[model samples]
Target: MSQPDTLGYLVPQFPGQTHIFFWREIAALEAMGVTPVLFSTRRPPAGLIAHDWSEAAMARTTYLGEVSLRRAARVLPRLPWGALLREAGRDGIAVLKDVLVCAAAGEALRDHCARQGISHVHVHSCGRAALIAAFARHLGGPGYSLTLHGPLSDYGPGQRYKWRHARFATVITRKLIAEMQAELPKDLPPMILRPMGVDTDYLRRDTPYRPVQPGEALRVFACGRLNVVKGHQDLIEAVRQLRAAGHDVTLEIAGQDDDGGGGFRLVLEQLIKQHRLQDHVRLLGAIDAASVKARLLEAHVFALASWHEPLGVAYMEAIACGVPTIGTAAGGVPELIDDGVEGLLVPPKAPEALAAALLRIAEDPALAQRLSTTGRARIERDYSARLGAEVIVSEMRKALG
Candidate 1:
């Protein structure tokens, strides 16, 4: 088959703080001679748009949430109301309202694709973005696919309705495939295991890996959203434990809370002050990708204690940068990092175990060196953003066929 000339890329909020992987994949696809028309449910909050590419990305994106009375009047008359009502009836009242709102966006999506000559769309979300695409197809728009980044429960309701009309779906982990199969119907579309990836070429370490020498201050780095489920507080406690044990440790967490910088960051700050770790811990709010890479290179260890991560691109970035990474063995993380091979793993919410893992890497230079070497190798081997883009392109072709 000939290569697709144009493809529609849908994300909930395009170019958010943690969406560097999507940007990387879009670049890879562009390099493969495919033009990706960007689509999003809405623009993210001003603070969440932290990437350097945000301006260019926003300029090219079509936001469905920018609904105007004129556009709605023009599109609503052509919607597949009967089909949408029938589907929503099977779910409940909540889904009925959701489908109604998304169906309008769907009509707008259809018109956008028609104008751009795009025949297929790939949604990087399983939430309402999936619904918008599905509704667009019902209105005789483009065929669509979905990429499930986390558990289905986290995305919201109406799972069956969302997956019913998709051409195919890509999941980030094998465990999620099993969960999807068990929850969704058997008559669903083809499911592919395509993990999220990073740009290894850019994330590569420029200098040699330097293990922390004896009695040197241990610099630990973590990157993730400031959420309770992310377990940033637990990581802070681990730093406190390391300090109490006469080990000099400094932790720099690079991320902002969902509500700009005011929400969970305050809680974490209180914890830091309560423990009197005012000087030891620093919260770096929502650094850019280059800044994150620079921090990873400067740090002796990279760690994020997510209670349940589907698969972590932050961990991938750190490992690719040759930082000895530590992650909780909660979700798809174990698939990315072997317990004792590429990096270290500990149970979630266990500050003591987290402290032990940090100490082990801090005390043993050999273990840190081994993890750093093998971890970078692991990312280079199976988790480059280019590889992920190839899988997506192949799947899109298959779906088009």
Candidate 2:
């Protein structure tokens, strides 16, 4: 029987504001009378235990060592056949490194569980946590499972690799589940029926703010990492077009670039200068979650032009805050927003369509109000954190059944 009192929740790190999914879900599981033991590379918060693996920074952000290790694993299969064997032989050494990582991680977790009288382990992402969980289980640790989010878990061979590990899988959308299921055998365990959730408590704010005026500055807000797939470029251009047409629209982009990533930030900067949008745009990097929420609370409308949104929590939060959304119809967006309801969906990479939706929302107050009321209620009914946690615990129950 699975242990009900203590659940070890694993994350590669514990500091990302975007991935509060992992941390907040832990909070959810904890409220279910299950102790959540969070395993991370960074030192845990007070009264919470953490294990450190290695310190590597991307964009000055310290992440776990497993990230680089996973990248090296990807490179190993591409070497010359002779070199491949050499690496394969050294794979034992690599395994030894993993052994150390898992030993530290598992001991921290297992010891915490033993003292607290805990039983099961659950990892938030399938990448490093999958390996750690498998290793921990091999070490005779707690029965474990993993929850998968982000493209790293779904894109390319990593998904296939991670598939070999998780006991019971959880994804945020139907598309992600289908993609994973199609890639694997039929007899694999059923994917959990849980999606990303919104903490209605934060979004349940009764604060009302006035929107941007058409004759005045039409302030547009966009948030997310400045990456290609996020479609921030398209958003900037759309804002430029509106401004060029005598609409004084100012675009405020609040996020960090992927830091040595695709140099998408340079591309965006060039686009902004070429369009002469010096006054029309503001780029704010990496604000705290409460600030993001505050921004949402004060904004006229919220928009995310991502080309790969598989159930973005941002939309749920914006909708819950009564900020109508204009999102790309890519990925799980269509599943979340109903046209003329909670929000509107536009085709990805299409500035004109996004601009049209923006214009509609900006012009019609009655439509926006109806959407806010209905959307907020939808959050309360369907996407509450408590509801999401209950769903997770139920998934565990079914697996144990």
Candidate 3:
């Protein structure tokens, strides 16, 4: 069959590990004869884009933020003056800066896509990039759509505005869809349920699951940005308490501090010292994908006590590697992990509950084995990247018709 028409992707950053799901989805779509052209708002740091898999992608991505606006007069006639003024009135002075900047960049992006014959645009988040797509569409550009993910607090002034104008919107989980419906009851846009996916083949572990023995130390691994929302502090406290209770457990956390400065790292260090858990908890800084897989292979249990998350991919990765996963009953996580079937679910910020779940896995070998087997099977059956890309393509086809 001939290749499908190319689709433009408006994203905050291109080729960053944080958005690995997008990369996997694009790869799957390419295999099915769909081309994805990336348009990023900002170029990420060199260190973040250093992965071998992202080298070619970085070269192809266009960073609109870095483009100088010398031809502003040339694209002035394409501006949607009525839509711009109405949006300005709705948000007051608060959105004026974003509106002006993103609108200009949107025009440039629109012209670029027009030259490349791209007729449809998809934005990954409801941030400035989504606003840019909406602005472009209002200026007689291509029809656009949005793929929504969230912490629920990041939806600002133009969120509802973008949703209302897009061709259709997609959310990664049902929980997020419900939240969006409740927020925008009046002009709620059409929504589709499309969950992110993982590559089961790349994440599959060859070594079989080994249960913890009486005298061996139980290895626990967790990975994500070490920010307050991730609830790494709560995980540390749980491990400290577990060690105090005479359980042979060691927790290894792999992530970089993301609190602007080094303040968050200091707080975690203080907690470790106060509990005298110097030997029990190891702070392994941010690691690559290979390192993450290696750590998961050695771990008996994987846990991330996030107080708020929009369907964490780390949990899915661990589960695919045959490790018994533990996650809080936060946003969209319960959808990926059934309470006791795929993995254990605990309440956020509750060290006692987290400790209880860890102990349950440590004490029951059969339970751990069952979770591992079922979790991997779930990924193979429903969470492949191709499945998600196929659903998105189906929606795109309908929108075109």
- Best model number under lDDT: 1
Structure candidate 3, residue pairs in collision: none
| Model 1: CA > 4 A from native | 1-3, 69-91
RMSD of each candidate relative to the true structure: 1.8, 6.9, 2.5
* Candidate 2: clashing pairs of residues: none
C-alpha RMSD between model 1 and the true structure:
1.8
How close to the true structure is residue 234 of candidate 2, measured as C-alpha lDDT?
86
Residue pairs clashing in model 1 are none
Off by over 4 Å in 3: 1-3, 46-50, 69-78, 81-92, 259-263
Is candidate 1 or 2 superior in lDDT?
1
lDDT, candidate 1, 1-401, per-residue tens: 23266899999988799999999999999998888899999998998888889999999999997776576566666766675566567666667667656767888898899888889999999899998998788788899999999999888766776788888888899999999888775647899888998998899988888989887999999999999999999999999998998999999999999899989999999999999999999999988888998899999999999999999999999999999999999999999999889999999999999999999998889999999999999899989898877877888887777
lDDT of 3: 0.81
Lowest lDDT 10-residue stretch of candidate 1: 79-88
| CA error at residue 60 for candidate 2, angstroms | 21
Question: Pairing residues by index, what is the TM-score of model 1?
Answer: 0.96
What digit string (tens of lDDT, one per residue) describes model 3 on residues 328-352?
9998899999988899999999999
Clashes of each: 0, 0, 0
Which rank order by TM-score, best down to worst?
1, 3, 2
Q: What residue runs in model 2 are displaced by over 4 Å at the alpha carbon? A: 1-3, 41-117, 150-165, 208-214, 260-263, 397-401
